[model samples]
Each structure stands twice: as C-alpha cells, then as structure tokens.
Target: MITSELLEKYTAVKKTFSKNETIFEEGNLPLYYYQIISGEIKMSNYNDDGREFIQGIFYKDQSFGEPPLFLNQKYPANAIAVEDSEIYMLPKANFMKLLEENPSISVKIIENLAQRLYYKSVMAAEMSTQEPEHRVLKLIDYGITHFDFKKDQNGYLINFTRQQIGDLTGLRVETVIRTIKALEKKGKLKIINRKVYR
Candidate 1:
C-alpha cells in the first residue's frame, strides 16, 4: 500500500460515498487510482441472470481496480461501496507520474499486484475442484492471512457476512449457512452470537 504521505504529495483527492453506491461500473475506462480511507468496498460483476459474483472486498488503506490502470484497459468489474465510505482518488496521469518518480512505491505496487494474482490463481483452482466446505475453508484462511486478522482466545474472527462469503466462494447463501454449520459441528470453526470465528 502507498503511504498517506506519498498520496498527499501526489495530491490525491478524498471522496465519500454512501452504502450501495457505485464507485465505478464494469467496462468503464480506468481513469483513477482509488484507495479506501474508511468503510468497505466490493468489486463484483453480475451474470446474465443477474447473479452477482464478487471479485474482491477491500477495506481501509487498501487499493482496488489498479490492474486496468496499469494495463490501459477497461475495468473488469464494478466497484460499489458496502457502507458509508471515504476514498482517495488520484488521476491516472498523476498516479503514473508518482510511480515513475518513486521507485520504492512502484516496487510495493508490483508486490501488491503479485499477491492479488496469486490469490486469483489459488481461488480458481479451489472453485474448479474443491468441495464446498473445502472452498469455504480456503477462503477463510486466505482472508485471515491477507486481511491480517487478529486472533483472540477463541480464534480469528472473520469480518465478512454469510452473504458475502457465499458470493466470494461461488455458493448460495443457504449453502454457505449449511456448510458453516457443518464446519462448526466438526470443530473447524465457532459460531458465536451468529458471527463466524475460525
């Protein structure tokens, strides 16, 4: 992630959005680099039948939709605010200039992109060949590692909702519910006060 100081030096503009608001639509030209300052955002796409497939969820200090910026292509998915959120947006030209002028920041960006690519590859394999339970567990494990989850005496709490889990794992919400219950029964995770902890 780029530091606040670097972002400020580049004159990133802070913008806010309400819950369910579209930040950018799929197929739109990538014109800016966006970094979350507060709340949650989801990058997703809808099928012909209007079924939603979540690409990823991002939290504060995280950037989204950067691949297209670097590749000079249209955005592959829509970005929406999941809650009232604030974000910093830098114009594409300025962002490119920033990277050009800051070698260390450019290296960090490359590392971030590589991590995302790795996650996508792993998830692709899980989706194609894994059972529902296995896919769900793998997603939870990935979230814990990628999101830097904090552990308590019980376990690491996952911050995603059941619906979000279903979307991310390509399962229905009912299936997610059933699989999570089964995982709990098998002592794989804990369901405390209707929230999941792994």
Candidate 2:
C-alpha cells in the first residue's frame, strides 16, 4: 500500500494527476522514474513548428522516466496524463538498486524500450510503403495487440483522438480525418465522439 518502508528503500512516491495535466516538462531535471498504476500518460515532443508529436502512450502497469536514468540528464519529452491517473515515483538511485536486486525488472524495462523502438520502425515503414488507410489499419492492429480493441456487430472500439492518431502515424490531421471518413463510408469503421469502431 505504498508504505514508508517501501518509500525509504525505493524512493517511491504516489502521485495522482487529472486529465491534461503535465507530469513533467521537457528539459526539466529527470530526478525520478515513474510507473503507471492506472490511466494513460502520453510522452510527446515539440516540433520546430511548435506542434506536439506524440512519441508514445503509457498505460496501466507501464514504466517510464527511465531514459533520463540512462542519460543522466533532463527529460527529452513532456509526459502528460490523458486521463486521471496514479503513478509511483522512484529517485534514480533507488530505482537502480531495485534493478540490481531484481534483475527481472530490468529485463522487463529493456523489453518495453525495445517494443517502443519497434513501433517507431513500423511507423516509418508504413509511412514509406503503405497508403494512409492501410497505415491506420496497421496502427489499429498494433493497438489490439497491446490493448483491448474489441469488435462487435458495428465495429471495433478504440480510444484516441484523430490528432493523436495523426501524431503517432505521421499523417496530417486532415488526412487522418479524411481517412476515418472513408473507412466509415466503406463500412469498415465507425467513428463516434472520437472513438473508433471498426
């Protein structure tokens, strides 16, 4: 239950944030590692045009803030909660000790990082070879692998804003909107209130 003993040994702190709240800003000192207890946190970077490009989204049981642990510097991207969320914080030193004590956690962390890299590669490949519609489908497939994108009589239910989808898939917002509309027309997808039913 996040006891003081646990806090002393691991430098853990429990935090809750509301939707649209920034957990940590880019370029700020990366003093702690974070693990999501519940809800969604998005990691995003700013482009030259000052647009936010979503790098990744962390869900329940995911850990982030490890890049800074490796680099010994500030955060590369901003972490913001997409919904109300709880996270466990660990200072760098204590986190390393936990890794040393339990090697399996380290393995899981490495695997998570590898998966993130794989997603980026897939996005790049899709951008070069696939049409926008196919790209969206591929992304939905990936999400199904990672989350629960269930299909019913109507379609699949997937959570994401069109802008967020565009940010991750490297599609323009207009293109994403048009592609969703096309999918709806084709009877392959139905988007209602920002949720994709496919």
- Please give each candidate's TM-score: 0.97, 0.86
- Candidate 2 to truth, TM: 0.86
> What's the CA error at residue 94 for candidate 1, in Å?
0.6
Task: List candidate 2 segments past 4 Å from native.
Answer: 1-9, 150-155, 192-194
Sum up the clashes in candidate 2: 1
lDDT of 2: 0.82
Q: How well does candidate 1 score on lDDT at residue 186?
A: 100
Best-fitting candidate, scored by TM-score: 1
**Model 1 worst lDDT window (10 residues):** 145-154
The global C-alpha lDDT for each of the candidates, from Candidate 1 onward, is 0.94, 0.82
Candidate 1 structure quality by residue, lDDT tens digits, 1-198: 788788978999999999999999999999999999899999999999999999999998999999999899999999999999999999999999999999998898999889999999999899889999999999999999998777998899999899999999899999999999999999999999998999
What's the true lDDT of residue 28 in model 1? 99
